[model samples]
Target: MPTLTKPKEHNRERPVVFMENVSKIYPNGKTAVQNVSLEIEEGEFISFVGPSGCGKSTIFNMISGIIEHSVGKLEILGTTPTLARQQSTDVSFVFQEPTLLPWRSVLDNVMLPLEFRNVTKQEKLEKAHHVLKMVGLSEYTKALPRELSGGMKMRVSIARALVSKPKLLLMDEPFGALDEITRQNLQSELLRIWETEKMTVLFITHNVFEAVYLSTKIAVMTPSPGKVESVVEVPLPFPRNEDFRTSHQFSDIAAKVSQDLKF
Candidate 1:
């Protein structure tokens, strides 16, 4: 059996996200989450792993300011979630689906966020081109959504998310629909991008191996009325590659995360 490792300590001078006794209850009296508190430091890559309907996405929604928490305090970058979203380019979200406009070209889709900002057309194009290149999609700038593979479309979605230069990136199972190989490839690519961009990431996924492979820390939540059951640390160093995936440390960490999810 592999030994379980505790999450590493951080400086904790200031957290990018802070949630204290947070809960989300629907009007119908369904409580999706209860008494959940978590702190994420800047530039950390954190993954949330749990079974379906465990309120993982609910947490994401709360952080993104799409839905307010019913009780307790939630802060993003030291401000209210709503205020953080409206006042700063601090948060971005990538959903399960790419959700790209089929008629729009790759560059256009990536440029969509900048359209709402004060940037000029030339600036938007320049930023879009830069981000697309970062995601290895510069050659597909003119292709429409229909012309690209599922993985390519997701790359475009990620580019769009990065175009705004967010301090926090939230991804909710963005690669859930892709094939295993493609998903693994994107996982590696995302790690590279995360390192290069130096942005904080909160990723949600059902795949235990994926959560273990990509995150510095894994937040394991119990089923419904979800609370964080445990936070597991992956002690493996960064710049992980294919060999890392097959190593004993990787399997051990993945097994520990999987064991935690069983509760």
Candidate 2:
């Protein structure tokens, strides 16, 4: 069994995530990813973009330890991917939809992670309420999933992921299903969360605008044995707001990423 090996003291030299020439191939020899390498610094927000079937999600699965790589090495928080994932040491995944339990109340749902790890009831309630407040859902603690809007449910999912205090967050198109207005709102919320929590985020999105709006770095990929084609750094300053969206720099970077994705 794989065991977690977090450093006794936090090391400034260690990256939050590192994929060194990683690749994944299926049993039938279908190459899902090839020679992909990435290094994510602590507290950085990154977006991975490509057309459908570009192996974007496959990379995320490997980082999350849901799938093992066929070649090369990968590490999350200096611990092996399998150990990091098995222990839930420093990573969380937010899937496309808000997969909240329909039967559970909002507070209970947020506390589910604690339950999974055998946390005390008092600590679970406290942690759940704190994160719900951070996500602006404190008052709805007792409300059932059916009572919340789509956006609110997604917030619940986010709160659940955050309650674990993960250092690395792997998001697979968490906002793909929302309407334009809600999507933008959640995007802003995501940024706010990142700023306050200082977590390293690896987000996967097909929307070029959304990718540019949220990322500190954009990793572009190609399909059919997916490989990273380019990695562009966002030149904009931190604490970016609505005005930055209208700036020329944002447009230029977004355009460049768009042009790269076409291949």
Q: Pick the candidate with the highest TM-score.
A: 1
lDDT per residue as tens, model 1, 75-175: 89999999988987789999999999999999999999988889999999999999999999989999999999999999999999999999999999999
Model 1 residue pairs with clashes: none
Identify the runs in model 1 with alpha carbons over 4 angstroms from their true place: 1-12
lDDT of 2 by residue, 65-172 (tens): 899999988988998888998877479999998899999999989988888787888888889998999999999999999999989999999999999999998999
Candidate that scores best on lDDT:
1
TM-score of the candidate numbered 2? 0.93
Q: How far off is residue 117 in model 2, in Å?
A: 2.7
